[model samples]
Target chain A: MSGFFKSSIGRKYAMALSAFFLMFFLLQHFAINILSVFSPDAFNEASHFMGTFWAVQYVLQPVLIFGVMYHFIMGFILEIKNRNARVAKYAKNNGAANSSWMSRNMIYSGLAILAFLVLHFIDFWLPEISTKYIQGDMSGLLADSEGFRYYEELTHKFVNPLRVGAYVIAFVFLSLHLTHGFSSAFQSSGVSSMRKEKLQIFGKVYAIAIPLGFIAIALFHHFNH
Target chain B: MNLTLKIWRQIDANDKGKMVDYKVTEISEHMSFLEMMDVLNEQLVNTGEEPVAFDHDCREGICGMCSMYINGEAHGPDRGVTTCQLHMRMFKDGDTITIEPFRAKAFPVIKDLVVDRSAFDRIQHAGGYISVNTSGNTQDANATLISKHAADEAMDAATCIGCGACVASCKNASAMLFVGAKVSQYALLPQGQVEAADRVKNMVAQMDLEGFGNCTNTGACEIECPKGISLENIARMNRELLKANV
Candidate 1:
């Protein structure tokens, strides 16, 4: 009760809240990525705002980073505790009888998502900050004051098949992760009722939609000029 | 019916357990799971073999003493019943049934099919009771009016038999559902309102101290629960805990 966030259920609550927070960011990030496909100018304007705005950069990015890290830390912490919970495991235990396959294997999906995140940051977020702020090179990034290299860098990155394939696979894992994570998040923090049923249904849809949407976007950029 | 049984056998908590096979012939389909075991033990004793040791009492399933993890399920393949209530009719002739004790770090195997579930008792003692007035001047039970919805929910939560099936069914062996039910039973009633805040906090703390895993909401507990304890109880407990902390 004292360190509310440190308790078992409390840590789960924090993990759930963190997962929801990161899901919000994923939606926003997807919105920005899709904008590039429809209107590069619009994408550039949004990217410019996202990159240059003080609150978006200093305040939001730091918090978002912390959220991602917190989620990872809690995920592994729970995994370790869970492993130790069953010191003597069944020799012929069958898991598929009651629970979904994805629900039982969250750790593997999360690890895959974590791996993809490293590559994602390298391809996008890190380069964005490093080139502009750290190295102080603003060469062709702001070309003609009408274009942004943020869009150019996106196209440049997706032009490679290897990178696009990784994105596709990562999104697949992301979809699986969300299959359980989405609905489980609400349940962890005590969100239920007819709304809980609706959340479960919506969670299934979102688990497939958002990640598949990301994969489609990646492929759209990959095969096209 | 002649059935093959692969039962887990261990001398004590320190000895490594393994599945030992036995066969019982002319088994009646109407026999309860434990009754079938009785036949096997009689055969073992006649042959001067060590009979298997499994826990049971009030074989109708009310006592919650039967703790067999039969054929990968906590209470055999049947839903909403303990192993003792499970009948031989559920199995076919020549079928192989694997029986083992509920395995968890907190519930160490005491023998063949019995585990030390006193961890639950300790947890209950930690905060599963209400302060009652035994003096002659106690107030009337009807002095307080509780909503029907709350009363029913409390009753439903109170139906848990401390069976530990939830822990057995869980991949992580988490006891969130059990603790949730205990906490929710009191959380919904007026008699329990006085100590509500401390009850949730202390019960959850005791659960953690018992070395139970965190609830990842896999939900096998609710699904396999004999009383059909809802996962919503866990949600209620989480909400109660958060409210208490705040």
Candidate 2:
């Protein structure tokens, strides 16, 4: 019902849904990117398919963009409303006494991730869009050589130490963001209590492993480039 | 015990409040926190000064009327206890303790250390009870056999004293734990089945209208709750709402 979506719990439910979508997208994206570390040819093949496939390009990409935007916009609205809930703040709130620092500071970590997203978009997404759509180059080929453009471009981007440092830091923030967010999404989605402990354990593993994998990729390309 | 207290002072709701320092000496370590406050109030009355105003009813902690943010925590440093039940022995001698009223847009300050928690009453009014005729036609006891687990869960949920500590301790000032407890106490029982959907919908709508924040699942509420209410109640409420909407 329309009333459900308009309620506070409804808004949080929407947020959790979007978060799940984005998190799933991150997993698939990481899966493809990590291939570059193992085998550049496989990564190139996968990237080429994902880049040129009509369903992925037209349908999934747009949905992915919408999901990311929805999560951020809803997050901001919730943050503002929550801030307004307390007109006056306590002189001393020992948040660490009752909750984890990561849980208390989701907005800050989200902002950090958002900043990293801007950099990421500029570094990779923009160029990919410009090349494929604006320049009308569907061929996943390098102009200078006879090899696939995906792997070379991926390696080239990580050659800069500063960029790699920024990326590593961003992945760390992403890890922190996931530390609380992973299980929280399920909780918001109305998961039962019996499975919560297992979800938490799994959430911890995914939260740390995925970002650590991404960091390894960045460091690998940076050092081995 | 000798203690310095920095307690919030406000004459009325509209007035801006500030912390005023007072020293109390020769206080017994076994004195309850409210008794310590009473001692300070006695001192103030002797000097022709207005004493700090606070809310308290049953000193046994069952009433949930005593609310204070002591040393930056709801219900003070002690776990599973309300402010009235917090003993002075928890603090060391010569310590300076800060006392504050619960702060939330929904829970406005009526006076020093007292907030208007009638918003909770409004939410309760929305749908916290089940309506049944009791004009000499009440059902016999044990008419409906409920599972012991279900009864236990319902009783656990019912243990909530309507204290606003969950909201006070929450970083976002969310009332989900309180509402969740209220909803679960009904949802787990067969008597609450008839209007379960309407109850969740209306209560949540009223909760939003009251300007309480949404739950972010930080679990501070469970930790700070005097009755040890679980976050499972919240998840159950979420499920009930989802089911109601569908």
Candidate 3:
């Protein structure tokens, strides 16, 4: 395992596998949220279902959290290791000042995304799990007058301009993160075939589309209300 | 054309460097950037001042020796050409050009604009070669029948002169583009396939071990590369590394 981690291929494989887990989670989360735009009933049902699912709450949630934590830790560890290794060997002045802004600020972007995630969990997931599971306060204004909860809460939040704007800003950052992350994820995974060109195009489209989708939902609710 | 040069000056690797201003009144527009520097050095010599030291051997741009950060660019403002090939015509009269050595922790200053890029040589030494011995009676030249497409791609990758421009042009001082070119050149060729996994693994490890930064796929290195080596090479190397890891 140490030898594999030291090897380029090993590092790439680790990156790819971690990326796969994150992407899978993103897709699932997006799909679930997107339902709110079409049918509140569907979203509420799905949210309740997810909330009640013991397997997800116990087994999958821990795994997902582990994936997120490991991904963050390993990414930094690898970057630092690579950096230290480079400094040890060469002491040459080769011009590298002209490179792109994104290349230089990847760590910063990642940190921004991580910070967004923390806030996101606080805003939504914390209240969600705390109110539902911990306190069992499936009480007043939590569920709508019609006994619907998730959709009502989402629409209420979207009605507020500040909340909607925050969501939009978060989505924008997500798009920026994805723009770099998408291509890099593939490179890390070692998947650059002729298919790479296609993947890059797909990655860009996905980067734009997912964020746009979230923006669309937010704007739709913001405006319709 | 008359030009004012603000060149970085340092006596040794340990000395603090600064930009020293110099003037050259007569320079031919046809002269390369380095040739123009040569004219400035000649003027400095005539005035009993020390010549501005910069690296340049093959003014033809193939030696990978001419590394300069001119006016905030890796090899001046030119694209796909070394500083040795950059002509004076690109500059107008009265241009105050700021010339500095490439800055990276991995690439320390030697004197003036010169830097010690022997790290690249060491990284290459790690695994950038085939293990076959060069015997007097080796196999014929056509022993390997590589496809035209692969051969062309390999040749394109092989064009990297190890000038360290990729590192200089990169924001993180990442050598991904340079190492990618070397890895892809060998990986594409049948002669290099036997050790493809080992080659990529070793080279990339050596690259990181040398303190180069990570590639962010920024595409600046591609644009600034004197050889125009593609970022696809990086993607290719990444793919190879993934497979090797798996």
Candidate 4:
């Protein structure tokens, strides 16, 4: 079993597993975030549940953090090793002739998404942590208002045009990353070729729709705020 | 056709190579790419200069001996053909062709355009064969009934001639397609089932030890392959490896 994790295919398989976990998490995250546009009350309730539920806080959140870290660290390790394999670069490499740009430039897109994640954590997660743990304010409330603080915080972040622009750009990069990554995860997971074409179609839809939905949510909050 | 040839020239493995320009005039378009190289070499020999060395044998393309990265592509710009099989008709007059050896850390350039692909042989040595006994007590050839689909897919995987085009065409210089084809060629058959797990594990380990990169599914290897080896072979090998481990 240890040997399995050490082999090239094994490493790829492990990367694929982590990617699958993160992609699923992204879907759920989008699902909840989109609720802010339709109904802020429901969004706040969902956010409060996810933020403070014992099972989520004590169990899944740690696993999600580990998954994100593993994916990033392993991706960098693989990229470095891959670069070292060819010490001499081709004098003229026509990469566009065969592979998609998104497929070849996954690392750059990932880095962009990573940058966005830092911003995301600062805007939401850090404040939430401080409120719950440091301030011991588990009421999920506002200082001057009677309503939950989650929706207010969420909408307030998008009110700034510059922040909204950055969020939109990050969502575009996320789309690009997912365009290759969704089907690629299956290929890395050793899924057979027969079902691959259908999965690719589904992957395309999901890649485009989820990010577009995120962009709409951001724009809606920015305009409404 | 008249063309300017910018060919890589190197004294030996230790010497850094450079492209030397040589013009060949009145060349027939019907000539194969290697034949044009022959003409250039003959011109150099007549001029008291050492001819550029390149690997080629069985100019028909099955030997897999000929390997050249022409104009930023393995096996020139033509599809489904090795360098030896490429013809001058693919180019026009006044076209300047650039030819270089396949580049990879594992495939060191031996001379002008000849790279040492012994790393492939080492990978094959690791676990690319079955353990069938050939001591005159061999089982009947028709004993096992393989499905037609399996046989065809295995044959497709087996068509890989071991040329390094896949590696050269790959941006990462990955040999996953080669190893994948080799693994699939065996794993698809009943004869190769006995040592399937060990074969994939050992072959993959040897491939990594050769310093080849990992596959990113760019599909370049499949497109540039002389035999049109499908990307399916790669996915199949991935499945085989996973099945072996789990």
Highest TM-score: give the candidate number.
2
The true-versus-predicted C-alpha distance at residue A32 of model 4, in Å, is 0.3
* Model 4, span A54-91: residue lDDT tens: 99998999999999999999999999998998997777
Kindly give the number of clashing pairs for every candidate.
0, 0, 23, 0
Q: Is the docking of candidate 1 incorrect, acceptable, medium or high quality?
A: medium
Q: How well does candidate 1 score on lDDT at residue A88? A: 89
Cα lDDT computed for each candidate against the true fold? 0.89, 0.94, 0.79, 0.92
DockQ comparisons of all candidates to the true complex: 0.77, 0.87, 0.37, 0.78
Report per-prediction Cα RMSD to one decimal.
1.6, 0.7, 3.5, 1.1
Over the full model, what C-alpha lDDT does candidate 4 score relative to the true structure?
0.92
TM-score, each model?
0.97, 0.99, 0.89, 0.98
Tens digits of per-residue lDDT, candidate 2, B1-246, equal: 999999999999999989999999999999999999999999999999999999999988899999999999999999999988999999999999999999899999999999999999999999999998889999985998899999999999999999999999999999999999999999999999999999999999999999998899999999999999999999999999999999
| Model 3 chain B weakest lDDT span, ten residues long | B209-218
Considering just the first chain, candidate 2 attains a TM-score of: 0.99
CA-based DockQ, model 3: 0.37
Candidate 1: where is the Cα deviation over 4 Å? A138-146
Predicted candidate 3 versus true structure: per-residue lDDT over B64-113, tens digit per residue: 99999888778888788999999889999998888888777788889988
Model 3: lDDT of residue B6: 82
Candidate 2 chain A weakest lDDT stretch, 10 residues: A91-100
lDDT for B25 in candidate 4 is 90
Tens-place lDDT per residue, model 4, B1-246, is 999988888899999778789999989999999999999989999999999899999999899999999988999999999999999999999998888899999999999999999999999999999987899999997888999999999999999999999999888889999999999999999999999999998999999999999888878999999999988888888888888887
